[model samples]
Target: MADAVTEFVLTPEQQDLRRAVRRFCAERLGEDTVRRLAESGTGHDPALWARLGGELGVLGLAVPEELGGAGGGLVDQAVVAEEFGAALVPGPVLGTVGLAVPALVALAGAGLDEDLLASLVEGARTAAFAVPDRGGRFDPALVTVTETGGALTGEVRHVVDGTADVLLVAARTGEEIGLFLTDGGERIPLSTLDRTRRQATVRFSATPARALAVGAGAEQAITAALRVGGALLAAEQVGGAQRMLDRTVAYAGTRLQFGRPIGSFQAVKHRCADMLVLVEHARSTAFHAAWALQDGTDDPDLAVAVAQATCSQAYQQVAQESVQLHGGIGFTWEHAAHLYLKRAVTDAALLGSAAEHRERIAQLVLDGASASGGVRVATG
Candidate 1:
């Protein structure tokens, strides 16, 4: 009962939006649709993408209304993300809400580029961060950049939605880090294991670029944007994990062994129970991060790290365990369990890994303690 009624102090509007989005995903993008989308090599449904961007208005959930967005906050978008996760709906919800929108907003805050932000918010355009390289460690300082006339040149890899119309690229220009908006840069193809998200190795060979922001301020803006995106991705992972758990439980109940429900057995029951607990915990952590992000709390960054670390593991664990509990059929092409597993693994490493985020949290805590007047001498 508590599981069904677990409350997170959401506004009535947020609750209604959640219900609506959930119903929408269940009706339109159900198990069959999700399976089809995941199996596609492109890792997305372009038709569904158009609907999400143009009709459902999910693309603009985090965008401001004045800029043609729905004027919703991070919490509001988290509700939709939760539904997206639960349905295993494939596309770029995290790409748009988490990365693109936040990048624009952060840049706008710095008064960098209003036109880019407007295009992003209106859903007429999209952008992906070209931060991570082949090793997947995205340090702004390590990024190499060159400028020739009005063009910028460099090689950046693992860019999400790299095929988008616009790209917000972070490049190192001497001692200054720069954010560039490039509409037409050379995109090199890269092999991807996950079929639900597209990635590319970009080669900007003196491509025409507009400077969105620069200097240490660019690094700060990009980092803040990534944090926002990472927190939202956790919510998406929670949704996906919940859906996997539901599907696995339903399968366990129906798949017979020894002339009885497999779910009736202790082993299967334990696995299902563990999945449930992890999903619930992931939900709590994701909501906490979303709340902090929406409220603009001082500890939102730490909350984001915690949520990403916990939710990433929870998603992967639930997905893999769900597939295992389904038996041999789960390994086949007909079943959707493996698809969820792929999405889980891909998303887990997207923003950062569990280990990476945990390390970041430790560092943040240490920094906080150091900033607090060299620690307090507590009384016994």
Candidate 2:
């Protein structure tokens, strides 16, 4: 059997990509800009998004070269995603890159929707995955939208980036689930915990849609997209947790109490140390999942479940701790601590809660055991 887990290190090219993304975020996605975008109606800046896709080619990192992408893998995409999370860059990145693009690529496989994919890669268009779930779970079995004669009708709630230019919807027909691509839907934006991310209720009224995949093929595409989303989300959580840790440590070292730095206190020191431990653990699990997805490990589902479960809890804990460590200032609206804290809480519930992923992990392990009559041991 193949190794269940392997050491994952960034290549020289990936390292350079990371540095470049960091520099871009530092210069463009400052606190003021993030706040501005969050408060805006669309919660996105098209020009900035264009720069990220056209200039950096980040949106297409995981797409194949023949499909007009950068011809990179999930790991490369995760690197960019991590930076986006750390900077709290507000946009449709999670929906477009993490969900829609993967589903489209899987269903099309360079055979269909080439124009749409190219437009997305160039930042000329954005798309959202309309899975009918309010709790961030993407179970193809739960899809309620129905497709008939090439038209789709149903309502999907709590859709991430639901206001995008395109919609990739999962619809059912006579017990067979399929993916359909549509251009317009009645969108009602919903207020959410994290203003940085957008959600909506989309109603499709016999909307003409192009079928991407049907029956088993559609299920496979949806599953592939969800797994990729879960893994990349874990990487994003790691980035957010790391940032919270960095900020907390810096504040603790400078903030004074009793004429000595707060960081000098044992309690504060211990808290920061704990945050560091969580951040590092989260980083390891997240990147490992990315590698598994990219390399097609024997059990990518298990790896994704582990990463999502670990990273979600770690990010929430670190963000909450960062706020507590900062005292009253952290609770204020003007401070950045609350923003990261909100993002952490929202993200914990985004791709699925830690508890949910743990349940998935349990099921996957049990299934694997049942299939082989015993658990397969890792050889390397």
Task: Report, for every candidate in turn, its global Cα lDDT versus the true structure.
Answer: 0.75, 0.86
lDDT of 1 at 284: 84
Give a tens-digit lDDT track for model 1, residues 1-380. 11223336787888888888887787889778776776576556666666666777777687777666788887788888888777776665556567867877776666456676665554566677776522123475567766556688888777776777777777766667788777778876566666666777788887998777778677766777777787778898998898888889898899999999999999889889999999999988888777666665437667787888899999999989988898898898788787778878888778778898888777667655764456322110
Candidate 2: stretches off by over 4 Å: 1-6, 109-111, 133-138, 366-380
> Could you list the CA RMSD of all candidates, in the order they appear?
4.4, 2.2
Tens-digit lDDT track for model 2 on 116-172?
A: 989999888989988754234556657889999999899998898999999989999
lDDT of 1 at 52: 68
RMSD of 1: 4.4
Model 1, stretches more than 4 Å misplaced? 1-7, 31-43, 109-115, 133-138, 366-380
Model 2: lDDT equals: 0.86
Best by lDDT: 2
Model 1 per-residue lDDT at 192: 64
What TM-score against the true fold does each predicted structure earn? Answer: 0.88, 0.95
